[model samples]
Target: MRSHGIVLHSLRYGDHRIIVDIFTEAAGVVPFIVPQSRIGRNGIKASAWQPLALVEVAWQPNVKTALQRPKELSLWQPWRTLTIEPRKTAMSLFLSEFLYHALRREQENRPLFEFVTKALSWFDERDDQFVNFHIVFLLHLTRFLGFLPNVEDWEEGCYFDLQAATFSRVRPYHIYYLEPEESALVPKFLRMDLRSMRAVGLNHALRHRALEIVTEFYRLHIPEFPESRSLEVLAEVFE
Candidate 1:
């Protein structure tokens, strides 16, 4: 199946090889390798596959339903400014690593793909506070995974229970829950589509709160995923 996708990441397979992972707008996650990807300056080289680079991928299995490769390739973009911005670069790196492990392979997710593309474009355009971008991404991403929690799950001024992925007027059944203020803020973010760089109305403190919510949400749902290491640095930037 041929589709448009964004390169998520690439790492050396052996000594002189590259294993790249890409997420197609329609075809979830696909991974394949390129020979001699680590070749030096004078070799038939494969370009460095950076996170969020767009490409049209032609997926074909080598023999049966075994390992596949992209029969065709092209650069969607280079992300010039984003690659240079220290903060955005760190966030992108953290996000790519998180998705690399969490997103399953060969599933179809048009909405999630659309969200990520929107996010990358936002990173390219604006320079607003970004602590909220990941939080928004995680919230919106739940919809793609069929786990979108209803805001109505809690009435106004209630609590957001992360473990249950629900809401309540009483105390949370679990400790990792969103208080009233955080709950109120979620709907505002859930409605926004712009990137953090383009234009967003978030202060660092609110963004950090959102970040905490996001991490707890990840723990609630994605059991095996580890804690986000970039968050502390990201928090400092927000502060």
Candidate 2:
């Protein structure tokens, strides 16, 4: 079968092979075993497996095993800035890792796939004023993940209950809720798209807090969603 995919994670498998987890348009998250021989001047380059790299792949399915081998693999859309730019690269690493965990159990959803690909392409094409990109990306991603908070329900002095994915006038009975002040930002964030996000000026502290809340929101919704290690790297890079 042939499909386009975004590389989520890659690791050395053994002496001469590598295991790459790719989120494909046709199959959600799938692991592919790639031999060292494929990483050469005349074949698929090692860079093609890097985090967030977009590639076209052809592979035969094996009901017996979860890991499949790609027969034909090549770059689907070469990124001009995402891989080369420092801040964008950091965002890519953090997002790719986040998606690896977030989409592990995802099934084929063409709309979700299209959303991701288009967002990444938009991110890659931008050159500046994108420091808030990751935050906006995470907020928008919640929509496809089935736990998007109800921004329409937001009101003055309202709190956001992370566990319930709603805005309310009363504090949530549980600990997983955002204060009214922080909760106010949710509707604003939800209203932002990639282009308008740049207009919303956020300093380092506010940006970091927004990310923390969004990450925590994910943790509350997705069972066992561990903290992202690359978040620190991304913060430092943006700082």
In terms of TM-score, the best-performing candidate is 2
Give lDDT tens digits, candidate 1, residues 122-154: 667766655456667767777776667886565
Give the 10-residue window scoring lowest on summed lDDT in candidate 1.
37-46
Per-model TM-score on C-alpha atoms: 0.81, 0.97
Instruction: Give every collision pair in model 2.
Output: none
Deviation in Å, model 1, residue 57 alpha carbon: 2.7
Least well predicted 10-residue stretch by lDDT in candidate 2: 125-134
Candidate 2 clash figure, as a count:
0
Q: Give residue 1's lDDT in candidate 2 (0 to 100).
A: 92
Q: Which digits, one per residue and each the tens of the lDDT, describe model 2 over residues 22-69? A: 899998888999999889999888878999999999999888999999
Could you tell me the lDDT of residue 232 within candidate 1? Answer: 83
